[model samples]
Target: MVSKRGRIDTFVAKRLQIPKKMVRNLIASEQLFIDGHQVLTADTQIDEFSLIECQGNVLQQRQRAYWMLNKPKGVVSATIDNQHVTALDLLAGIDKDLLHIAGRLDLNSTGLLLITNDAKWSQRLMAPKSKVTKRYLVTLANPIDSTYVAAFAQGMWFEYEGITTQPAKLTVLSKHQAMVELKEGKYHQIKRMFGRFQNPVIELHRESVGEIRLDDELGEGEFRALSTAEIHSINVNASV
Candidate 1:
């Protein structure tokens, strides 16, 4: 879990479910150390990912959590935001601040969003080398045709990014809606792809990442902790 800055004593008290006075007494007895250095006062700030020990025994931190959220349209995909509510805020009964978003949804787009406290897992999920497939449902302003599918399959050169995107899978659902799967994230990739054909995107919703699909049971703004099998899905490389 990402450590929130606070007094070592206060953090220990809350984390261990003990009293602050007891934490102070433990520190005074030279029973506490932050990352292997003995500290006399509880006032010391806890550093991120620092190990805490009491009387030579390491304190057990809570297990890391992996969750899937049906992100609402208005919330930002961040841990903290000054002017908007973040997706983490929807989570209850947990240290939401310790959680980090794996794949981000745009502010107006809504769908399956991944959140977790495992930094390395999140990092790997977003890494270019992983090539995890991300699936989205897109609605367009105009009716689309076979040309759109062919173009996407062949890969398109995005002028703004000055790079050709990897070949993407596009399936036409209706004249104005389609389902797309991409192995790489580009800035506004779907919208930009349709822009080539003079069609504006009316809506976009993510449906899944890798093998971990958003639970259909989850309504907008609702989230559920991932099961062990679902958590393991992040490590699996599968085509959407």
Candidate 2:
């Protein structure tokens, strides 16, 4: 209730069950605040994450939540799904409705997944201009050779999208496994990239997103809130 972002007067009125006139009066008397700052106008906009206070009493104070989940195979990166278990379903005792996946992995893919209620934070992390790197460990059906390294660096051309991929870094970890780092995520990019070599990706596990690595202690389907440093590492201009 009163969760959508809108003018402060409207939010305050709905949240407090008071008249709009009373909300304006509270603002005029300097008795209303948003995010700890005094509201100067009834028209001031506020989102669900905004901290609202009045007369030393908390009207609404919703802290931004960020989490890192070790997504297991077959779990869809969605808030809800009818045919499968969504990533949000794995979270316990948290407001799952307000959370969304930052960088989504396919149902068959596993590893590091970012979930948060802060839309701005997630948007910045996933923005193309941000160029945040995502690293993955891939197991292929065929042996990886030096050619694969050069091919990835050169970038692959997708006939359907009609756009070439950005230069990616690939390190051959073994005859059939390698580490891949990319600044962009396209539809089935990893699988399709391997497809160019006629090799199938049998396993794909993301290791990190930008500077936030998957916690070694988190088991599959387990998650923990992101640390202060981890949340700030995305280089978002605004505070969570």
Candidate 3:
């Protein structure tokens, strides 16, 4: 009940208010039927929306939830932390632990943070081989120029990794602000890339990920469940 996913035996025990051993006995007795088929194993995985009928009584499934948060600065992208408040703390009326951060925003950065319980969906988005584009609004301490376009398009070398980053798209929005799009994530990538020109980053915010753009109506710290179409935008095809 508290979680959307769990073993069938645990659900049976909770629903019947009996011990797990009793649930196992009931499973052995063929009293538990999952989706109308009698199951001998208590380990049958069930979701929040599973139709579990045991001796004519129906067990409800917990509906999966997905959300997008306009993450505010200073909130760490984590479920729990001892020193800093996490983005999950900003959410209300949901099981925070059940949800996960698909893409992390740095403590000093903000915008378009996705929250979901679907592991496969998140995995697809984070897969290194996936070409899903992440767009960011970057503020720099120096003025912008056309040379950055060619440099970013060609990729930047990070000495620490001894590897050049994947080609990125950089569009100048203003003297101090620019739009940057990348298909891969690197540690402090934008900051490090700009550091090559001695141009420090003043501010950073993620504007979008793939086809899912940040909701203009949602304020920082607020979130809403992703629409069906929005969820469909995630491309799981890894082979290209």
Candidate 4:
């Protein structure tokens, strides 16, 4: 659920197209049930994902939605942007207002981007203790060397944050390209790390997050609902 902070009376009235007083009556009379429990107060908090029933009629029963986008370069990972096309704009007809980006990519970065209506699920993945790994394919302006690999493994210190980064893995694929795996994401972390060598990142693309890989079949700017297995993978080792 995007938000579970709504009051029951307001939620019920809107869903049933009835007055607030009538919805309150339903709650007072014990006719309203949320997730099979009788509602005792009109002020009881509820969310769109809650299964609400009134006298055997289900009023709202929304399931959480999860999606993965093969993000295209130049698309902002946002719900709304005044100057650029946002990631939500690419969903077309779907009810995107309820969804949010789980892991964000830079405007110029491309590849696997997770979108979901489940906040807890996203929280579990992003939580530092979870240590969920993110893999990125990077193209650099300068030639790569073993020194970069050692520096990354030892973790670099960021002066702005006054903290050392978590150790990251760097696999040199070519003279100018490499694969980077990190357990944490800091603001401009990758770019800043490479900035130590005065090496600008020419290209950056996420290849995967944790156990879910970007689907090869999806073209740029295209997206699809995540599979049941993919959605459950994040919960396998960590508490959600």
lDDT of each: 0.85, 0.91, 0.86, 0.91
Residue pairs in steric clash, candidate 1? none
What TM-score would every model get versus the actual structure? 0.77, 0.91, 0.82, 0.89
State the local distance difference test value for candidate 2.
0.91
Write candidate 3's Cα lDDT for 100-206 as tens digits: 88889899999999988777678788787778899999999999899999999999888888999999999999999999999999998998888888999989999
Instruction: For model 2, name the residue pairs that clash.
Output: none
**Worst 10-residue lDDT window, candidate 3:** 231-240
Q: Mark the regions of model 4 whose C-alpha exceeds 4 Å error after superposition.
A: 1-3, 6-24, 40-45, 55-58
lDDT tens string, model 1, 1-240? 333567898878987899999999898888999878897777998744668888877874446778999998889999889999999888977786467898888899999999998776777788888889899999999999898889999999978789999999999999989999998989888888889999998889999998889899999989998888877776665322
* TM-score of candidate 2 against the unseen true structure: 0.91
Error of 4 at 210 (Å): 0.3
Backbone N/Cα/C clashes per model:
0, 0, 4, 0
Give candidate 1's root-mean-square deviation (CA, Å): 6.4
Query: Candidate 3: lDDT over CA atoms?
Result: 0.86
Sort order, TM-score high to low: 2, 4, 3, 1
Residue 75's lDDT within candidate 2 is 98
Candidate 2, residues 1-240: lDDT per residue as tens digits? 123668999887887899999988998899998888999998998888788899899988778899999999999999989999999999988887578899899999999999988887887888888889999999999998999999999999999999999999999999999999999999999999999989999999999999899999999999999999999889653222
